[model samples]
Target: MTAGHLAVIGLGPGDEELLAPLARRMLDDATDLFGYGPYLARVRGAPGAVRHPSDNREELARARAALALAQSGRRVAVVSGGDPGVFAMASAVFEAIEAGPPAWRALPVEIVPGISAVLAAAARLGAPLGGDFCVLSLSDNLKPWPVVTRRLRLAAEAGLVIALYNPVSRARSWQLGAAFELLRQVLPPDTPVALATAAYRQDESLRLHRLRDADPGGADMRTLVIIGSAATRIIDRPDGGSWLYTRRDVPD
Candidate 1:
């Protein structure tokens, strides 16, 4: 009997064109698909794939269900909006595997990579993260508030450009503000900050501001915030808008 397999696939940001070809083929060949409702909706119609859509917060349940389907002699694909390994379903899937039945460990599990939001956001913003950087999720749902703040402080002190995910949501609106305040203590007020919302999507929005002037109100769950390091600088384009980038220090 052939053993079943599980594929944790990244669906890219929002644009379907950004979705990797390997991911598309995996979805086409999957017997069962699992992901948040909106992400699963992107797959027009896989011939024989059964999609199991769930709420955004129910990751563990989704992972477990996908694993179970794979164990039952089915080709399973667990989809995530951004790169699965980047604060997405990949970690949850592995966590479930570690805690699941011993037989589950022997199952063939593969992770197909996809373009992450940070990379897309940075590309749209003139490479603000071309230098050393760190990515942080501002959502305190899985971790403590203090832990997030501490990391922000340390990243800022280390002079690393920071990319923030899940910056704001309906229930959690003030955390982004607190994060900015914490960075203000370590970074200069004039530090460049880039806000990219729904990047590459129809409703995409991009904005640039100094650290002190950044408005947290503009942020949302779909937004990815990039804060420039001390070495970062903005170049004014001859047309109008500015291009922000971090200076790469090398031999003269």
Candidate 2:
């Protein structure tokens, strides 16, 4: 077991204040921090900590860098936007440690969870996920398309509210449309759908539309789509905001 320790911190969406007190303290005290380029830029001022930036395809490399620094007895903070355990680098970190030196198995690792994008989007749309929900990433880069499609079908058929991440990207535009088509087979055409773009960021945009009308082509990598179940109701607030609700039947 390595004598060093590593702290994995989630920075939330884009706001610095959303960072937990513990995460802020770790970032401040750490001698080295690692994260994707965009997520790393959010850290305010930590002159003592050296930043290690990794591209999207270098998950293993990023994990190795952080583990190496931690194994060397340096306090290291690995930053991830949203919740690290949710489609983030937390798993990669663990996988790297498991595959490395035997001492790494004993390293003290702390995973501090943060607000995920789905939660942020749900809050923005007024509790769209107040009931049963499932989060799915539309990016088939890692998972096969068949597996993604099957999960979508099952989730839709089970009437579970859906939170979609990485819905659409430049190179994978058709995937969202395909998913939409699959979902429509099991869900009502008028099911409420919330498209949240760059959520919690300065350029945030939130749009509430019916599943039948939501254009998947308009979505981007930063967009999160919340598709309500059949029982979900949309109430328009007098203040021009909308609220979604799912009622549970009380046993008589």
Candidate 3:
């Protein structure tokens, strides 16, 4: 059978309104789909799509299934909540394709970008990433702890506004605490930080706090942390929502 194409659709955070028209159209046209179960559930109304749901540990399996379906000439959409390219399923899909049968290699692949957690968090808290920023994932599942720690420290030392994905999980409870300690060594206690939970979802909560006051105890895999650079400032807006801004200083 001739291999079918792969459409990597980023379904956005969770709001139906955030999904791009093209992404919705692709999902509507897919005969088979692959993604984490929760993400698939969000788009329950998508037509004629067979979902292959998998847990975090089954990423390789999920990718392989998607690839296999595509190779069989079935239009497949690998769904991801938020943008797949930003610390999501895109890498896993590429890795699976690289490791799959030769026939799968020639299949066309398209990545449709969506609103990443970093962007959603930044939007909720004004423009904390107006200057330069770096994104770091605290999950050490795929990478070594030392490497994650090193990048966190380096990004902090460089004074880049940092957006943290996968901040903490039940199994990785101490990683965020260690990251806080490392940031404290380089940043002031009063540095601004924003915690966006379940962004763009019905239960969304946005909390703007100081670095010293940030408590990772309430954080989970769904939380996105925005740590301000030295130049980032928090201003009280007359409209009730606070604005976090990172000022860019140009050389004379």
Candidate 4:
């Protein structure tokens, strides 16, 4: 018997409208859905055999479980927030496939992309990513902190707009502070910064600040932090807020 199909999808930030049509279609067609509790909660009326909700830290375990279901000829869908390919379950699934039995490779797998947090945040904040940009996850759960630090420094030095994901969590409250300190070392004090929290959600809030004054204490897992490059600019909005963007042109 042929192996079942597996589809990995992203639900986008926190809004249903941001979800890609392809991802919604896959979710509807899936016989089994596996994801973190919060992300799985975003899916309504899936009509699947069951929704396997697990902790956020169990990516590999979740991926393997989903694959096993697919191997048993069940249409399985693994869901994540934002683009699954971006620091999400797609990598975990691929890693499992590469190390699992060769038969696992034969199963048909599709990646259904969705609006990443960076894009959603950039849109809400008026295009801070208009120029070259780099996306980094500050969580050192999978990688060493030094690696993240080095990448952050280099991205800043290269004048790339830096979009930071998972900036802070309860267990690691100091990471965002440390990250901001690092950025301050290379970037000017007045560089534009944007904090997009829960973009598009009901409680969504976007704030603009200068690098010197940006505080990390308020950021959480739901916040996406943007550190602008030299060319980034911010203009006051009519409503007393501000819009930020990076100038597309750069001199030689």
Give the best candidate by TM-score: 4
**Candidate with better TM-score, 2 vs 3:** 3
Global lDDT scores for all candidate models: 0.90, 0.83, 0.85, 0.90
> Could you give candidate 1's per-residue lDDT for residues 48-71 as a string of tens digits?
778899998899999999998899
Clashes of each: 0, 2, 0, 0
* Superposition error at 136 for model 2 (Å): 1.1
TM-score of 3: 0.95
Q: Arrange candidates by TM-score, descending.
A: 4, 1, 3, 2
User: In model 4, which residue pairs have backbone atoms overlapping below 3 Å?
Assistant: none
TM-score of 1: 0.96
Question: Judged by lDDT against the true structure, how good is candidate 4?
Answer: 0.90
- If the candidates were sorted by their lDDT against the true structure, best first, what order would they fall in? 1, 4, 3, 2
Which residue runs does candidate 2 get wrong by more than 4 Å? 1-3, 249-252
lDDT of 2 by residue, 123-223 (tens): 77677776788999888888999999999999988878988998977677888888878888888889988889887899898888887877886678889
Models 1 onward score TM values of: 0.96, 0.94, 0.95, 0.97
lDDT-best of 2 and 3: 3
Return the clash pairs for model 2, or none: 1-103, 2-103
Deviation from truth (RMSD, Å), model 2: 2.0
